[model samples]
Target: MAEPRNCSECNDSLYGQQFILKEELPHCIKCYETLYCDNCIACKQLIGCASKDVLFKNQHWHGKCFLCTRCNQSLVDQPFATRDDLLLCSACYCDEFSAKCHACLRVITPGSKKMEHKGFSWHENCFTCKLCQETIGTRSFVQKEANNYCLICYEKTFALQCFHCMKPIISGGVNYRDQPWHKECFVCSKCKQQLAGRRFTSRDDLAYCFDCFCNLFSKKCAYCTTPINGLGGSKYISFNEVQWHKECFNCKKCCVSLVGRGFLTCNNDIFCPDCGKGI
Candidate 1:
């Protein structure tokens, strides 16, 4: 017959009885629990043969003690996360540590898509245009104040319209007469020449080049038959529904200046007082 076995710790008889092998040594159930059972990492209680044992990273815990430290929910056979040596279920881990979406102010769970802008974060679905209420995925976007906008929505809502073409002026525009204009659209009304970075004038709300303005609108001198430029505060003489340059306002017979003094007009000709007596 085989030799009768005995408990390793207490030397008790193990004949025809159940026993536990620890380090290849046979022990009774009571001795095995007292001498070789693992203590629970969570509850600090021994995990005996009668109780289910859970082991993680070489640490042991009773089945009842193997739960999320935060929510106290069972982590057995479930996804879990560890933070600062504390066990947590996936839900509790996400709630306690995941980043929050900037738009909806809700937690953004791990393994989900997210968007980051500036210094804030958002869930993929929550990152949407403020005006159109549509998702703005990987496409281009714009941010205004505290709102996000799709490129189309941003242009429609905020871009200025060109004064001439009436189209959206996305960039590099001119502000004239309290109206916005595209650089290419701000041209002389009469000649169609580009007036940006060049001298131009407005007449009756129409923009014109200097030459066009002088020929189309400036007063003509009576004697010289030339346009009398009045831009930049230049002085000119006006009388009898006609205008003249100060140098051109001289007597026709004696060639003496008739400016700021008594003068006579004979058949659209100007004469000084002394020359007019003889004329």
Candidate 2:
């Protein structure tokens, strides 16, 4: 007669009753479940024979307990991701941890091209010029007022135009008379001398250096015979189609002051009324 089977742990008789084989050793159902069944990682409960067991990374979990840490959705046979060792569903993972494009404000998934600038990220196709609407892939760009633009579009849209050359002034330009101009283009119209960072004058909407303007346009003082440029707020006297300095406008014979007083002209010389009789 064959030997009778018995439970290995409890030593219970296993004659004509359901038993479990653990490592080729016969064990009672209660003993096998209590001694050898896997404990669920999620709920810390034992997984029995009638219960569905889920396995991941050598950790066991009950089917109902296997869920995403963030959304609490079941991760059974669905794509999932792990962040900081926490289980997460694909959608929840992207929403919670993925990089968002700065331009389009969309998710920048893994394995896709991305660009980053000033702590902001962008999808490759979405990073484009705001004005031209063209992709700026690994190319030079400008950011102004929270908008991105390519070099060409930035210059055309925001750069100052030189009043003299009529070209775009990208950087380091001069401003004169509320007009913009390139440094090299801001030159005297008469002598072609550079006028930037120097005293200059304008006539008929044209720029001229101080020397050139005084020599060409300033009127000569009748008494002093010197150019009266009216610079430094100096006052001058104008009469009989001639200009004179305030101190030089005097009678020729008596040397009396003639400013705001009646004067007489003798052979292109100014004399007071009393001095005119002697002359």
Candidate 3:
């Protein structure tokens, strides 16, 4: 009979019977299955193998040994910072290193915070008084001299007077060029909301900014008094200063104008007595 070979792993001599190294043995080594050694290729120490093939990459770590550099708290499964030799985790990084704007809550990147207040930081343009929430857009605030007011706040607070009406805005206003205006005085060049602080004024007595007063007003409906869009049912006529639908005009004989009456309909006509028979 042939003598048995030694076991490759333990290097122990096998007598008479052949030593069979099981397939599971090599798998166990990769997964830190052996109790003697726990080191891994990534230099991390392992506590135990979660699976047959999965080895704990950090052999030095007993279990989840990640720590934040700033706070030194266990990182667990959270994102760890890998910046510039620092092993900080997310929570510690944000608390200790990241800068945030004091007024707007915007994240201030490194080298971006132009001003610092009580340890909080801000962008270069963020520190102006007009940049505050209520002051932004229509009106602007100046420290010494700067164009920082957003736009809206600048207009509301500073505009001088209405171009068309020449009415001064006392509460708040906009200044177009050297002229000032009330918001209601200037018509929107786009939507026609008075462009109180609009830069450009048009030639027509109906001066409008680029934003307000874009669409021209057409003929107005006599009945509804809204601009006409060509849905012709009743002919509209101008009586006195006001326009009225010819069919809707009332006669004194059919409807009596009564005081404090909500509505009166007669002879297919509606009348308000205070306005009289021609109404």
Candidate with better TM-score, 1 vs 2: 1
Candidate 3's displacement at residue 106, Å, is: 9.2
Rank by TM-score (best first): 1, 2, 3
Error of 3 at 268 (Å): 92
Best by TM-score: 1
lDDT-better candidate, 2 vs 3: 2
TM-score of 2: 0.54
lDDT of 2 by residue, 59-95 (tens): 9989999899988999999999998889999989988
Task: List ranges where model 3 is wrong by over 4 Å.
Answer: 1-8, 11-23, 26-64, 104-132, 135-148, 155-279
**Distance (Å) between predicted and true CA of 233, model 3?**
79
> After superposing candidate 2, which stretches have Cα over 4 Å from the reference?
1-4, 15-18, 160-279
Candidate with better lDDT, 1 vs 3: 1
Candidate 3, residues 1-279: lDDT per residue as tens digits? Answer: 444355546555555533433552322233234544454333354445552222223324433444666777765566666567566776666556677766677666554536654455667666656445442322334332334444455545664556657754554566555676666655655556655444545655446654233224445544454543334454555544454444434434544423234444443334675544454
